[model samples]
Target: MILDVQGKAAYAYTGGKPFDASLPSTVFIHGAEHDHSVWALQTRYFAHHGFGVLAVDLPGHCRSAGPALRTVAAMADW
Candidate 1:
């Protein structure tokens, strides 16, 4: 799914489950060298059981839109 984050597009894999706002949400964020696919299997497992898993592609990475944030602090704030 595509989400709007800080006015940019953020890509998130939902592990094939339709989102249910009532379900607890879990976000799987990858490192600088990777994308959402890195957590593919894990996201699926969580989504299927009871969680709403979001395996996200950070800004400027993969399907997300961005000029990458410069530091961990920026990323965290983002």
Candidate 2:
């Protein structure tokens, strides 16, 4: 799914029925050179536990559009 935060797009995934806002949201940030697909195992594990998990791509990588990894702040901004 797509979560548009502050007009900046954040891509994610959601399973099961409609998610409940009260439920916790888990954001997974991949390691260097990795993409959201890397978290496939974790995503499935968490979802099975009834948690809302979002494995997002880092900026400049995968579906995210931007410059290459430059700094910690830049990565956080992704």
Candidate number achieving the greatest lDDT relative to the actual structure:
1
What tens digits encode model 1's per-residue C-alpha lDDT throughout 14-68? 9999877799999998887689999988998999999988888889889999987
Worst 10 residues of 2 by lDDT: 12-21
Off by over 4 Å in 2: 15-19
lDDT at residue 55 of model 1 (Cα atoms): 88
> Per-residue lDDT tens digits of candidate 2, residues 1-78?
666654555566544334456668777888778778888888777766878777776666677655557777868765
Q: In each prediction, how many residue pairs overlap at the backbone (N, C-alpha, C within less than 3 A)?
A: 0, 0
Best by TM-score: 1
Model 2 residue 2 lDDT score: 64
What's the TM-score of every candidate structure? Answer: 0.92, 0.72
Off by over 4 Å in 1: none
lDDT of 1 at 60: 89
Each prediction's whole-model lDDT (CA): 0.89, 0.69
Worst 10 residues of 1 by lDDT: 67-76
In model 1, the clashing pairs are: none
Clashes of 2: 0
